[model samples]
Target: MNVPKASEKECIILTISGRVQGIGYRRSAQQKAESLGLTGWVANLENGDVRMVAEGTPDQVDALELWCRNSGPRMARIDRVEVVRQQASGVFVGFVIR
Candidate 1:
């Protein structure tokens, strides 16, 4: 994917479903986000979904999405990914597994 020259940070909320729980999805997501210089947190939902809130440049966000789709984890089987863009808020310091 082509990296976009982003001037401002972007916020995105990603909802991942399908065999997300009990896998290393959250850890992998946190590592991926941190490597891309993103700030966010990842958590497992009660309904067997994984939720992530991330903030970074468009390119970084796109990379994270691509990684999630391609290789979430060994035990994860991603069926769907829902992403929503929102106004950026520079509140988080680093990516974390929650």
Candidate 2:
């Protein structure tokens, strides 16, 4: 995936779908984001989807998306991922699983 050039601080909302619930998707995401020096939160939506908001440079955010697609924990089966660029909300200090 081509990484877009973003400002020094920016946020992107990503909606992930597939067999992502009841697995370690949220935790894995949190860990990965933290490792990548990103600030965000990931949660499992009631509709069997995973939602994440990651703030960082475009490269880091894009890298997280790439990792989530294939390296999501052992039980996750990610089918599709939808990402939307957005302004940073500055609500989180670290990556969290919510």
Candidate 3:
């Protein structure tokens, strides 16, 4: 069985769609998350979406979400951002682009 060793309450999984791929979204998200002291990864989905999982304080997570909603990299046009809250696994060390 796979289980988290520690339960971090502030964690989020984001599915951001629309003009998010091939436009530095993953890298920019990584930088933003890292700067916010978040731990997790951002990657491009095969279906032209961007997926991000981040673990941090509620404020940090909110900040990241706000960034995604309002100000992604200049080139990206964000259409829909779906946010899912989950218990953090405390498994990541730093933010990265997957």
Best-performing candidate as measured by TM-score: 3
Query: Residue 74 CA error for candidate 2 (Å)?
Result: 1.4
Find the 10 residues in a row with the least total lDDT in model 2: 1-10
What are the per-residue Cα lDDT tens digits for candidate 3 across 1-98? 65334454478999999999888889899999989888999988899999999998787899999999999889999999999998788888888888
TM-score of each: 0.89, 0.86, 0.90
> In model 3, which runs have C-alpha deviations exceeding 4 angstroms?
1-9
Q: Which ranking of candidates, highest lDDT first?
A: 3, 1, 2
Order of the predicted models by TM-score, top scorer first: 3, 1, 2
**Ten-residue segment with the worst summed lDDT in candidate 1?**
1-10
lDDT of each: 0.86, 0.85, 0.88
Q: Which candidate wins on lDDT?
A: 3
| Clash pairs for candidate 1 | none
| Candidate 2 Cα outliers beyond 4 Å, as residue runs | 1-7
Candidate with better TM-score, 1 vs 3: 3
Residues 64-93, candidate 1: write the lDDT tens digits: 888878787888898999999986787887
- Measured over all alpha carbons after superposition, the RMSD of each candidate to the real structure, in angstroms, is 3.8, 4.7, 4.9
Give RMSD (Å) of candidate 1 vs. truth.
Answer: 3.8
TM-score, predicted candidate 1 vs. hidden true structure: 0.89
Q: Which has the better lDDT: candidate 1, or candidate 3?
A: 3
